[model samples]
Target: MKKFLGALALALALISPVAANPIIIPGDKNQRLIANNLYLTTDSLFAAYMSENLEQRRLAEMYVIGVIASSEGESWCGFKIASPDAVQEQVYIGLKSASEKLPKSRPAAAIKSRLKEILPCKK
Candidate 1:
């Protein structure tokens, strides 16, 4: 058991990832890009999110920041909040609680974030 533990610890140390600066961007209930300048502010972003294609949404974010020429699959969607350090945690929560007007879309789905991956866009 001691040898196993030592090997596991060594493996973990060797595989550990280098951390980057943490950034959180506000997203709507649909987890789409609601920011006008950052994204087109279209239903497509929402639809892609509904389809669970979070990759697309992330791509859109990357486009906003010029990090990528265009949004492709699973790429980070670089959205800039109105100002630096302006983290609106409520925006996503409010959007989740609000009733939806879109037709036939399964009732309002809550937008949530997972900590491990930083897609920036969360739903």
Candidate 2:
């Protein structure tokens, strides 16, 4: 359908790959992976910013609940991040996801670490 094609085109145009299955510092056990590419329906880059902000905020939601919340909310931004050689291609990189899913005690901490690599280096 025309709609489908248009949608595909829009997606390719805006989103560019930044990181893919990126391993955070401290080795595989300690590090985490981030979904580089993001897709937005309307808000575009602003939407991505909002999602990242929320993911950063919910660092202490605690285990399961936190992961669920992050998964449902904009934190993941509707994208799935995959781990290295990960069976599940749909990866969850939210703070809670990072904490619960990663080896680290805090997913938020893991996310921040990933962001350090993601965020443009300060001059």
Candidate 3:
């Protein structure tokens, strides 16, 4: 048991630094670019919205819904959406407009920023 534990500690120590460093292939600049921009962007969200696949559309709607739900009750930019269907439509319109205007922005940030404009909380 002692020998096995020592070997495990030595193995983990050797693997830690390799895991910490990102793998960069020579002359593969695109790989580094992709690695840096791994998170969802508005362009991808717009693609999902325009996709013919039902699942893609559903997931995009859900993503918008999540952004809305998370921003609720915040005194600054909270919004009161009427119904699930209506909220989806309204937010989609907002997202579509935002995608056209700000394609490079993060979707969650875009949606949150538009919440007050699209569905302002009643004062």
How do all models score by TM-score?
0.21, 0.21, 0.57
For each predicted model, how many residue pairs clash, with residues at least 3 apart or on different chains?
6, 3, 0
Residue range 22-84, candidate 3, lDDT tens digits: 221223333343342246568677677666767656766666766777876652244334556
Q: RMSD of model 1, in Å?
A: 17.2
Q: Which digits, one per residue and each the tens of the lDDT, describe model 1 over residues 6-76?
A: 56754553454311101112233434433323322223323333333456546433432332223212233
- Residues forming the 10-long window of minimal summed lDDT in candidate 3: 18-27
User: How many clashing pairs does model 1 include?
Assistant: 6
Q: Pick the candidate with the highest TM-score.
A: 3
Model 3 clash tally, residue pairs: 0
Give the Å error, residue 20, model 3. Answer: 32
TM-score of 3: 0.57
Candidate 1, lDDT over the whole model: 0.32
Off by over 4 Å in 1: 1-42, 60-89, 94-123
- Write model 2 residue lDDT over 7-110, tens digit each, in one string: 56445543534221111112224333232221211112222322444442232222324343454323332223432322112223433344335432443344
lDDT of each: 0.32, 0.32, 0.60
Compared with the true structure, the alpha-carbon lDDT of candidate 3 equals: 0.60
* Candidate 3, pairs of clashing residues: none
Ranking by lDDT: 3, 2, 1
